[model samples]
Target: MTTKEQLTVIRRLMGFAGPYKWFFIWSVVLSATISGINVFLPWLLQTYMDRYLRTSNATIQIMWMFAGFYFGGMLVRAIMQFWQNYSSTMGAEYMLENVRRKLFSQLHAKGMRYFDQTPGGSILSRLMNDTMTFANFWALLNTLILALFAVVSSFIAMYLTDVKVALWTLILVPFLVMTIWYYQHYSSKVYRRMRERLSQLNTKLAEAITGITVIQEFRQEDRTSKRFQKTNQSYYDTRKAMIKTNTLLLSPMINLFYALGTALVLGLFGVRGLHEIVAAGVIYAFITYLNNFYSPMSNMMDSLSDFQNGMVAGSRVLRIVDDQTLAPQQHPVAGATITRGKVEFRHVTFAYDQEHPVLKDVSFVVEPGQTVALVGQTGSGKTSTINVLMRFYEFQSGEVLVDDRDIRDYPAAELRSKLGLVLQEPQLFYGDIQTNIRMYNTAISDEEVRQAARFVQADEFIERLPQGYTTPVLERGTEYSAGERQLITFARTVVTDPKILILDEATANVDTETETMIQTGLNKIQENRTTIAIAHRLSTIQNADQILVLHQGQIVERGTNDELMAQAGYYYDMIQLQNAAHKD
Candidate 1:
């Protein structure tokens, strides 16, 4: 990542810590205290060896007092360590929760066009891996703090012991610092590459798993396996390259610093000709302290790669959290109510991409309580029209009005509340049937729930289940058949009692028997509401108040069902084709 990008990501991650300012402060204090205790341990050992060991007044009282101080320090260090872990780890976990929540909200708030442009697996990876990467940043920050304190305090003690020996010991510091800087600069790039490769691997795995049914249907298992193997190999190769470069370039330099420091200490001791300048015990203590200093420095260098990888991930996560939410229109429609369910689209033109207009100069209207059927071939923009009506995608030109007010002047949430949609692919989460039915509305009564279910003909199957409304639905409603899932979704829609109802091929995947049941339920629900149905099968919508035949992003033919049939236009040809196919 570029320096600008890294800084941007860091800023975003830090923003999440705003809620836990006190906890962070406490954690830092505890971390410093523990570091202080660690620094004093070597000095205590030196005192025990040089002073206490050779002293004539070696009383039991003095030994016990020394032991008490040592244990007291150890106890304090242990308590501080506990606080550091609890505060820092909890802070990271809390931040992760907030990040995940915000990401979900932002993703859902985004226009459908955004989802169309992005892949499912790519989004999923960001939610999972990117958040995890940010969490590692907290861990790295704590480690770095401890390492810094130990290095500084140890150096101070070494200097106070003897200036000449300290000077020789300090010779290796510059070289070690330079080597660490170089390692961090180069390894960060390699680690970033590794993270990117891992993300790709995650995306590929998700795709393969989700598309397994399609792969089996097409008998492409061997091909899929080969593709997966290729992705896995690429990930492995990138990781191996990162490890190899780190080992060869970083570890050797680290070992060289240690060797040079040891050589300097011995050479300086001989040059000073002061064998009594620092005691044997003091020399041993210095060596021990030197090891302490080098260990954290080396570990810090080694862990720098993980830290950078996390930083990169944190940057991606922050981008999503920082995205501008779709702001409601400045002038909201005041006290707007659709008493007559009138919808009008005037000169409406829209496109997910600016250069490619999907709907051009489209115009239409539906009278109060009327059912409008939109007929279109695949990719003829039938769904896009519904999307426009729901304001899921903003139009480049034109106005869509519900009743007499423009939709742009309405709060998005308030506007969507009046509409109930049953999509072709019904989604059900992990929960009981009752929870799925109620969804966001908890105050709804059981009578209302049952009535809605009956209105959609879903009560019959729901009652057949062993647990009825209490039956647990697994992820994506895998426990139920496609038709059953559709029925439950239809029930959910009716329970809300939306003013406008949209069925975008709600019965497209069901059997004939299930279709008849759903059609009956739809008839009951649409009696007093504005209904918009999109169907490929013209027969299903033959009785619509108005039928629109869309072709290539334009409504070419539209009228009452009989009027379009009499004209022998696109709808007439399609109905004829379907009838012929069924008979054959």
Candidate 2:
């Protein structure tokens, strides 16, 4: 990213701190107060040295009083320091949490095409690692503020003590600025490389884990392991570069200037002493002031690397926040709803990327309480049709109407609540069968859950499992059989009692026995419902009221089952191929 772009990202990240900015403001106040105390302590010691310790009138009582005063100063400084650090840390934490929540919400609001194009690991890395890196940048922010206060206050103190030596110290300011500029220019590129490598490493790791079963089954573990090792090595190389830049450009360089500045202060004072007596307290105060000047600067230098990391991370995270591939929008009118599930697609054309349309001028209508089955080969736009109807993707041109009203005219919730979907692969969360059936909808009582389960015949296998409905599901419910998982999913959908039912090749994965069981449930759920079925098995939808055979991105045949068979077109050929495979 360019320098201007990095600044833009940082500015946007700061916006998330809006609600909790008071904590940071209070911290800034305390930081300034601490800087004041830092100046006061050296002056206090100088006063004691010159006024009491250097004079013959010094007494034990005076020493004790000064010691008590010094101790009190330390105590107050320590307390303010604590609040400064605590408040800044708390503010950073709150900002991190808010940013994470917004990122999660943004991901959910994106269209399916966004997910199709983005890897899960890349998304995970940005959401977790990048946010953490930016949050840690607040430590740099605190250091920067402290440095600002200390540099100014300590310089004024030194200039007040001796104008000539203080003027000489200004000579180093140009060199310091140049060094900082060089370090920032170099380290930003290094951090950007580090961030990219980290994201790639995360992607490799997630892919290996997600497809571990396939890797092991195909005996490709060695290949995956080697690839992962290479990615790890690349990431390690970037870290080594980062460490080299930080070591050379950070604290050591500031300390170098500090050592030079100290030498100059003493040399000037020594020369002055040769001509006339100079108070030891004056020399002591000058050295201490230089220390104060450079110490916070050194810390700020060390945090420069973190600032770069945060800039790069913030840029990546904000990309997701500003993504334009949002879920299809609705133009709903108040009180708009689906009274009857009559679905019609009028010459709809849709594509994921908007360039190569997967659904082209597709038109279909399913009457209320009627079943229409889609039959096609893979990539024949079978799933694409369902995607548009579900409003998961926006069509470029078309009018999809439900109950003769524009699909976009109904509120999104109204559409989702009234349309039921069961996928080929059933998904279950880490919950019991009862909760899964209810889908965490608290309004659904246990009795309703059971009724839905019984309606889908899911209660048979569920009752046999130990603990029945309360049994804990682990790791995506792998403990349950495929048929059992599908049954639970069926119950989940039916419990909502949707007006329209959608089956997306729901029986494609199960065995014949499981298919028989799932078919029984489908039979019960399809009764008196507007149904759109994607038939994976030709025999499954032989009795459909209407059948549509899609080829490429258009419907090649459309008619009742017997009529399509008589035509012996795409539908007839698909059925023949499936029956041939079944006989084998």
Candidate 3:
């Protein structure tokens, strides 16, 4: 990146400090102050040696006073160091928290197309690992600033003590600067690769874990392990390259410069003769300052590596924040909220990739308090149609009206508040059954929760559990059977009492008796609501007010079940095929 672009990333990362900026500023000030005091200590040592130790009037009391002050100065610096460390750490953590909060909110605000196009593990890597790198960025920045302050202060002290020796010391400064520049150039490229490899590793691991069941069923553990090893090896190689760069440019190189500068100083003293122009005490002080000076410079070089890593990570984070491709969270034009749950799709067309259409001029309508069933072969655009209605993906060249107003007219939150959705796979959080049903909405009373669960027949199995409604659910509600989990999801949707409901039913995962129970619950929830269902079983949607048969991204037939069956068309053939399959 260009210098200006890198500065822009740094300024944006620093902006995340927000209200805690004072903490970070104070920490820098403290570090510089402590370093300033340290520079003064070497000067004090020189003064003590000249005024007391080398003089004929030197006394025991004077030595005691110097010792007391020396130790006392050390004590103060130690206390200041503690405060500096605390403030810097706290500031970095707070800034990290703020960045993560904003990033997460932005992710949630993005349209479904963003999630569809991105991997879950890549997102997690940015959210977790990259954010952590930003935290280290702040810490390293503070250390670098502190080190620079020490280097400058020590240089000034040395120059004031003896200009000739200081000028000789300056000979090696150019080489040190060049070394740092070279390190940054190569380290930035390596760190960027390392971060990419880390993200790939995370993505591969997440996909493998998510599909663990399928892998086990097929006994493909060996193949999966090899796939993971490929990613792991790539990450390991990048890490090794980073380690090699650090070893070459950081401590060892700085120490070499320190040794060169020290040898030059000793050679100057040897030529001048010890007691001549520069005193022995002054030479001792210069040696001490010379060593002290390189300590922070070396530290600064080490921190530059972290700074590079942070900048790369920060750039990734900023890309997500700056992405403007997603539809805005707020509606551009204000209109009435969805009150009646009426929905209409007028010649709607949509494609994930605009080159290939998923829904082609699809037109449909569901009047208020009516249930519309979508029946289609897989990839026939049933789910795409539902996605359009939810405004999860925008449809091209058509108007999707909710409550007789364009979907674009209402704020996403306001429109979605009136709708409920149940996916094919029901997702439950880590909470008790009651909390899952109410979704932790405080406005829902306990009584309302029980009523909703009872309405959906979820209460029958929930009550049978050891703790009933208070029973704790494991991740995704795995402790419960598929039927039981679906029942809980049913209660979750019914509890909202939404004006519009969408169900993508998966009946294959449950037994016949559980399917009947789910159907009864579905009947209760669809009453007096605008319901749209993607039917997996032909029998479940037989009573829908309107049944739309979809084929190849278009509605092939639209009618009530009896009316469609009477025609003996595509709907009839599907029914006959399903019946035959069931009989066999």
Candidate 4:
């Protein structure tokens, strides 16, 4: 990212904390108070040395007063520091929480096309590491405030002690400013490179874990390890480059400040013969104050690099939020009872990529309670048809009507609530079997859940498992086989009792026995509902009232099974192929 882009990201991130501006203001106040206490300590030390230690005329009453001031300042400083830490850290956490929430919501609202183009690992890193960088910016802000107080207080104290020495010390300020400016300019580039490499590392690690099964099956573990090593090496190289540059710039800068101060102090005390005139205690105090001044300045400069890194991370997160513009609903559509699941696709045309259309001039109508089956080769637009009907993807130039109303006119939530979908790869989250069944509509009771499971014939296997409906499955239903997961998904769909149902390759991976069981359950669920089945198994959907065969992006054949069989076209050829494979 360029400098302008980074600044924009920082501005956007700061906006999240706009609600907590009061917290930031109080934190800065507390930080400055603590720094002010630090400035008073050197003056108190000088007083203690000159009046109490060097002179025997100092009384016990005066000693106690000095002691009280010394410890009192310490106590007040501690209190201010405590408040500063609490308030600043709280603000950072608050800002991070909101940023994380907004980023997640934005990502969820984005279309499937965005996920197709973005890497999963990169997204994960932005959600995790990027938020951390934003929090670090808060710490840098606190440090800068403290540094400001220290620099101002130290300059006033030094001038009061000795004007000539203060003038000599002030000469190094310009050089110090120039060095920090130069370092910040170059360090930002290094930090940006480091952040990019970190994102790549996250992406590579995610890819390796997600594809571990494929890697092991192909016996390519060594190759995968080698690739990971290359990524890791690149990350290390960038980090090292950043560290090397920082060390070279910062070490010299710190030494230069120290050398300048030491030379000025020595010249004042030795060459000018001022040691007898100036109190030893005052010179010691000046040295301590000078160290205090330079230390925070150096830290502030170093933290500027961290601030740049955080800005880069913030930019990545904001990019997602700004990129996708979600389609808005002006007003909630009045709930219209879908008594009949009549679906009509009127001149619907869609393209996953604009240059290549997936569904071209598609038009179809399904009467209420009718069963329609779509048959097509892979990528022949059967799935795409279902996707558009479900409103998972929008058609570029077409309307999908549900009960004679455009689907777009309905609120997306209400539209989806009326439809049930089961995919080829059924997903079961990490929850009890009962919870999984009722996931689609959680308002349903346990009894209703059981009824749905029984209707889908899932209650049988579920009852056999430990705890029956309460049985907890692992992630992705790892505890159960693929067939079992499909059964659970079917139960979930049945529980919702949607007006329109879509089954996409639902039985493609099951055994004959399970397929028979699924068919029985499907028959029970499909009764009196509008159903669309996309299947390669012609036998399962042979009884469908209508079957549409899609070739490329066009529907080439449409009729009942017997009607299409009589024609002896693409449908006949596919049936023959399946029969031959079965015989073999």
TM-score of each: 0.93, 0.98, 0.96, 0.94
Identify the leading candidate in terms of lDDT: 2
TM-score of 1: 0.93
Single out the weakest 10-residue window by summed lDDT for candidate 1. 322-331
For model 3, residues 1-584, the per-residue Cα lDDT tens digits are 55676799988877788679888889989988998888878877788888777775568898888888888889999999999989999999888888899899989878887887889999999999999998999988889888888888888889998898898899998998889878888888899999999999999999999898999999999999998999999999999999999998999999999999899999998888855776767988899889889989888888888999998999988988987658534464755677899999999899987778889999999999999999989999999988888777777778888887888888777776788988888788998999999888899999999999888788888888898899998888888898888888888888888899998765556678998886777787888899998977888889999999999999999999999999999899999999999999
Residue 476: error of model 1 in Å? 2.6
Between candidates 2 and 4, name the one with more favorable TM-score: 2
Q: Which one wins on TM-score?
A: 2
What is the alpha-carbon lDDT for the whole of candidate 4? 0.83
Measured on C-alpha atoms, candidate 2 has an lDDT of 0.90
Per-residue lDDT over 1-584 for candidate 4, one digit per residue giving the tens place of the 0 to 100 score:
46687667767777889988777889988877777787799899887887678776578888898889999999888888888888888988888888888889888887777787788998898889988897888777777788888888887787887788878888888888888767767877777777778888899899998788899999999998998899889889988988887787775676778778877776776665643566766887788778777877778777777777777677777777888644333244687546678999988899876678999999889998899999989989999999888766767897888899877677777666779999998888887888888884558999999998889888899999979999997777878988889999998888888989999999997778999987888998899999999988888989999999999988999999999999999999999999999999
Model 1 C-alpha lDDT per residue in residues 1-584, reported as the tens digit of each score: 66676677776678877887666778878867776787687778678778877665557887888788889888888888888889888887887887788788788877666666666776887899878877878777767777787777777777877677877787777777777667667767777777677777887888889888899999999998898898889889988988887786554666777677777776676565554464666776677667767776766766676778787777666656565534223257677665667788999998877679899899999877899999889988899999888777778899898886887776676666778899999899899888888885878988888898888888999999999999999989987999999998999989978888898998887788999988888898898899999987777888899998899999999999889989998888888999999999
For the record, the alpha-carbon RMSD of candidate 2 to the native fold, in angstroms, is 1.1
- The TM-score ranking, best first, is 2, 3, 4, 1
- Native RMSD of candidate 3 (Å): 1.7
Which regions of candidate 2 are displaced past 4 Å?
A: 1-3
